[model samples]
Target chain A: MEHLDYSNQAAWTRVSGDKQSPVALSDSLAVKNDFETTLSFNYDHTASYVRDTGAGIEVGLHGTANIGNRPFSLNQFHIHTPSEHTVNDKSYEAEIHFVHEASDGRLAVVAVLVQSGAASQTYDAVLAHMNQKETFDIPVDDIMPENKAYYHYIGSLTTPPLTENVEWYVLKQPVTLSTEQINHLKTFYSHNNRDLQALNDRPIISSN
Target chain B: MEHLDYSNQAAWTRVSGDKQSPVALSDSLAVKNDFETTLSFNYDHTASYVRDTGAGIEVGLHGTANIGNRPFSLNQFHIHTPSEHTVNDKSYEAEIHFVHEASDGRLAVVAVLVQSGAASQTYDAVLAHMNQKETFDIPVDDIMPENKAYYHYIGSLTTPPLTENVEWYVLKQPVTLSTEQINHLKTFYSHNNRDLQALNDRPIISSN
Candidate 1:
């Protein structure tokens, strides 16, 4: 635990196949998908009764979403300090991983790029419990931005075990957090984002 | 609870949307997706310890599978008598719902058609506890057949509140159970299957 071996990702000792995640995202390079794919999220409004996973994904969160014909249930989501997927080759302050799963055991991680800006009460409520280490549900419905446009691509889980073929749906629009909210997540795990992976000739489909 | 209200589905009163599940499946009508899609399952072997939901879907079983890039974790699975999704417009003897959920709270159900033939010892252990109402995990890895070919579609949950936009990956291959095994499951919920829903111009993707 002392030495976070993210260096393996840079050296390819742990690439786990070429389809790695946290790739550099560019709109110009992204192929516009022919079909209109609007992600519909029926996220639970009240995290009123969810067990706080701290920074894990094993809670029985009951939120759900649909992208095209794919159905994903919210397992649990956590923060990746400093954005993972870069937009226009630029990284943001932080990124939030709203990890979802389909019934077939496939993962569709909705990466919402987070930036420090106008005070967001929605984020404030979620962030308040970030450091508490208590049982709390992150009100995911409020975490989502109104814009649903996202970049779709086949990739791997950014974290350990680095499972490949995980769907990366990086929302085109970024969400805001107050400076306090941003630092609250950052203090837990600063510089926690993984090194960006190469696109590897993969087509990043833009949901226009 | 005395009278099952599946009649609502037959009368369209409970149709959450134009698209609902348990549709009559036909290969010729299924659109062959241009892309090759193979489902990969890395299921847990031991039912060693898992809480059985007693034909419900609120257990935290940790088997996972990948259909393309979508990742779903096995929440829990239950059986439906006389099958649900009919193949070639013919209903099978029984069906197993291996319900998996993605991180975003969407469901991708992999329906395995069942036929009574040879006794499957793999199933014998699972069936032993059907009526026991005990804490047991249905070994989903055992339930999936060797042949991965399936018919994929956009549908709603066959059960109540009937949420739509659920991805149904109905496996074309049918597995066998002994006459005794079939009877064991049947005794629990005889004729518990939902009525078939309209195809409604939904494209059932044949994953050949």
Candidate 2:
């Protein structure tokens, strides 16, 4: 077994781009661009989370995904407190990111917004194993909303090395978890989200 | 939500005892003390391994066991390459530590010595997730040898703080792993063992 740095080296090319992430998502501004090839998720296997980075918790994934006929492999997912990208200027309690990568180095990040309400068993499992820093079954598909409709755009990662050319999908429907669950996660991270960036005249595609 | 050292604080109590671990086990000099309540393992969950400790891979366990009717919950297990204790003055390839704790904070370390031979699927799973540092199902019982008989004694932990008063149970049977698997583990850690401790007048009890 080879000793690894445990990070995607390709994301650290040191290039800044105009299209940054966490932009305010407005339904009125987003253009409906529902094409024949829609986004599809083929999630399976339990994911393991790592606390190696100062960015907080990041869970490694081993699932496949397809966006507009382009194939990508899900690599990892992480969370942002108080949400990052707003839905029609309305911020939620939290946001979860499912990051994927293609063989050619293409990246796709499917994000889900979370609100306070009923308890999510999926969130419950993640919360139990979060501090252990060991891989427990993550149930990647359950973390998403049933609607599956989303807002799409091109943006760079909010974290350092700030890689660009990544595909961003912010789901339309928000999933609810018990307030205690959201609060428990916040205990590990709070206000860790990147500040809202400018849209820069970029068109937001709605996958309605 | 507080940051933790992730190690047992009780094991760090600084008191070097005459009865330390990794002592050479000699059957000819051992005494047979068969008790009514034998060692029993109740394992089910998949354990996740963490790579945080420089001492190499540490897998967190959620299983319970009984050593002579004294109940203990297993907290973690770790691998030491090139073996630690010698059986009949003959050394093996590796040694594994299943660190357990009783309600009263009494420590019990169950060890299994490994030799070079056939491949072990149990070891294969551990090798797969050792670097990932996430909790995967550990199947704790499989990690043990079929023979329940072991050599019992008193000792201190082999690592730092080296707290004494630990109940040591080094199984008599030596489990086997492929030469390649042992080498693969050696790639991560090699010759990382505490120096052989003296017998120091402690009687080794053989569960024959």
Candidate 3:
């Protein structure tokens, strides 16, 4: 299998362009607040979130999230330095994508933006064990934020063969990670994010 | 996430009842041998082939396989200490499930049985890297067999939520792994296979 270059002009590139990207979400879109997500940190140490780039320090967390009456299994979550999606053309320090799939094979992704601020215990815990080569367990709720407001849209995976029609929910709230933590992650994947992509006239919906 | 017990009698348990196992396959079944598969080691390390059992030492390989005119991406593959499916009441030492999914979220799986015989370099490579905590790349063709003859059927994932209507292709040929390799895998998951399920009158077709 060939490794995809995250910083190239690949068709599956996830970099969001300022124009045609997701706009400030509005409240007109249907909002479902009861999304239930459960996380288990029993991940494979050999799994890489991004191909090549030597960023193989990812843990597969087995989880399931219930959204809009549909049950999605949380397959994997990886961090992208400098983030993928932009808000009104503003990029964050990092982005965490919680990839979920329904039984029928439909995909729903929850994007959480990471910024430098107060130290987060969740981030600290993840960083602490990032170098472990063995599978372990962790509580899902401990790492998730209480805020559930999000910007919903339909987009494709930012990676190769970039499969489209993926249901995306970008949380309006940003998760806090200290400056030291952000820098530590960058050591693994610096500038390892895709360029902004065309929104193709997709509407960005927000939960009221 | 809490590790799922593979030996338990959960509703989604993969253990099949010996009395109602799949019978010998016939040649009348539709056997598509030319299904095209492309491999990419670009997978989310957070994804597990098995639902639980805390076997997080697995790797996620990304690539698409064309089956029945539909393109299914090779998301992840995992090993069961003992084979999950039985043929005419015969069970192998282990089973490898190559899980593939279509763009619309439909799943098609290819199951290859592993037994003790000559040393297999592919299995050795996978076992060699099983303890690594980082994601890396490997050739899909190296791990897959040249022969495509298989048994066709419709079943559910042996894991939780046990989604049904999944297209299954169990290769007729068994891959050989040294006794040392099989025992090494058992060290991680001795009785990790689920109990056999009742066939429910579903016909198993052979690609003869």
Candidate of highest TM-score: 1
Please compute DockQ, using alpha carbons, for every candidate against the native two-chain complex.
0.02, 0.01, 0.02
lDDT of 2 by residue, A61-82 (tens): 6788876455678887888788
Q: Indicate the fraction of true inter-chain contacts that candidate 3 also forms.
A: 0.00
Q: What are the per-residue Cα lDDT tens digits for candidate 2 across B108-199?
A: 89998888887888777777775676767655555688888888877767765455556788888888889898888887876666668888
Candidate 1 docks at the CAPRI level of: incorrect
* Predicted complex 3: CAPRI docking category: incorrect
Give the per-residue lDDT digits (tens) of candidate 3, residues A75-158.
877777887777756788988878887543456778788888876665555665665554544544533567766777666566
lDDT of 3 by residue, B1-208 (tens): 2222222312222222222222344454334332232222333323222222253224566665755444467877877767877665578888888888754345678877888887766666566566455554454453466777677766666554344446677786788788988888787777556556665555565554
TM-scores for every predicted model: 0.48, 0.46, 0.41
Instruction: Evaluate fnat for each of the predicted models and list the values in order.
Output: 0.00, 0.00, 0.00
Instruction: Look at candidate 3 and tell me the lDDT of residue A126.
Output: 64
Task: For candidate 3, give the lDDT of residue A141.
Answer: 50
